[model samples]
Target: MARRRNPFDIFSDFEEMFEEMLREFEKMGPGEHISGPFFYGFSINQRPGEEPEIREFGNIRPERGRIEIGERKPLVDVFDTDKTVQIVAEMPGIEKEDVELNVEGRELEIKASRGDRKYHEFVELPADVDIDTARASYKNGVLDITLNKVEKNKGRKRINVE
Candidate 1:
């Protein structure tokens, strides 16, 4: 008889959801964090790191919006391409309508609120972005933003006339 897949297995997809949850809390706001009592059985050295690096998402922080009964902090993902930078934020239990994206000079700003909770975020952009032509879109509890990189003149050339 063939063995059936166990949905409750530590390595199963169900457990992956919790892993995602932990990542979300790390990226969203500046607060305390704790590495999980993970059930996956992944070796301590094989995993990312045992250290719980708590980061405070500071710089132009937004005011405390509101708080709900059972709400978790959001998650954020940042990726950069050759000529563009993309930012994706996951805000579950919150609607896209409550999220806001803004680009100032060379910085990217993101704000989100759900129920009675609000989160403010700021990301500094590389020196290759044209804020005027940046684009942002939100769908399926995720916010996607693409910024175009600016073109600059190459380094100086030496001209010697003897």
Candidate 2:
């Protein structure tokens, strides 16, 4: 019989690898400072009849045996309804005034930065939304946005060329 593999083993392996990388950083000269506000996380979503979706968020990335830090991508969820589209994002330790949003057609860009925390995410809306009707609220590290969906064209329009 074949041996059964343990799912949690991967997490332990990841921790060991991460520690090794940190030790490599310690090898730098004493004058070098290794400070960090690093963030890394992931989310798994499984719908009723669809394949599981895995999403990675945060500012940490391993490239060519080195860790790269950049703007964190907050975990976001988009809900589409017949009349509206709602989006929720998790952005901790950020103020409402620091958040900036831009919407054009079916795309929405969210950006926020304060002190050492910075977040940026581009969301592709499921349907057309009325930019003027968008509403947003933030509280306790969560940002919620809602937009009214544009009505679909009833029928095809005939265009005449001169």
Candidate 3:
């Protein structure tokens, strides 16, 4: 007579199998790059009454110095109002003296450097602004810039119909 197995035994079996799979993945050679938490090159495409197709979908071999998919760009906000244009940027770990701002025509350029880290960004204004009237302030890793818009003359010109 054979001994009966408990239904919960299947869960333990799955746990052991998962642990073994993880161990095998950890033994990957140095040439292999692990980009995700779970199994690599594992994908399943399924359809009703059709066999599932397994395929590899992501970058398995990445080159050195190449930007990763998870890389992030700096956060910036530009607000355009009737009288002024305001720009805000987040630059942590840098002092006010490390930052430089330049405005030419309709463009605003920002540059900052601190030790080994450097940042540069260019923003285009919606309307022509008075660069001389631009005001900027930096506080607690946040930089705020305000530019007064060039005033337009409201005088109407009467054009004779040709």
In model 3, which runs have C-alpha deviations exceeding 4 angstroms? 1-73, 157-162
Superposition-based RMSD of candidate 2 using all C-alpha atoms, in angstroms: 4.4
Backbone-clash count (model 2): 0
Q: Rate the local accuracy (lDDT) of all candidates.
A: 0.58, 0.86, 0.67
Count of clashing pairs, candidate 3: 0
Better of 2 and 3 by lDDT: 2
Residues 25-116, candidate 1: write the lDDT tens digits. 56766665433221211221122655422322212112233211122334555666788888776655567688778787778778887655
lDDT tens readout by residue for model 3, 1-162? 976668745344444444654665577799986453222233355667987544322222122423223211235667889999999877676899988999999998888877644556677788899988889998998889999999998889988998
Query: Weakest 10 consecutive residues, lDDT, candidate 1?
Result: 36-45
Off by over 4 Å in 2: 1-33, 63-66, 155-162
Report the C-alpha lDDT of model 2 over 39-113, residue by residue, as the tens digit: 677777878998666666888755567776788999999898999999999999999999999998789999999
lDDT of 3: 0.67
Error of 2 at 37 (Å): 1.6
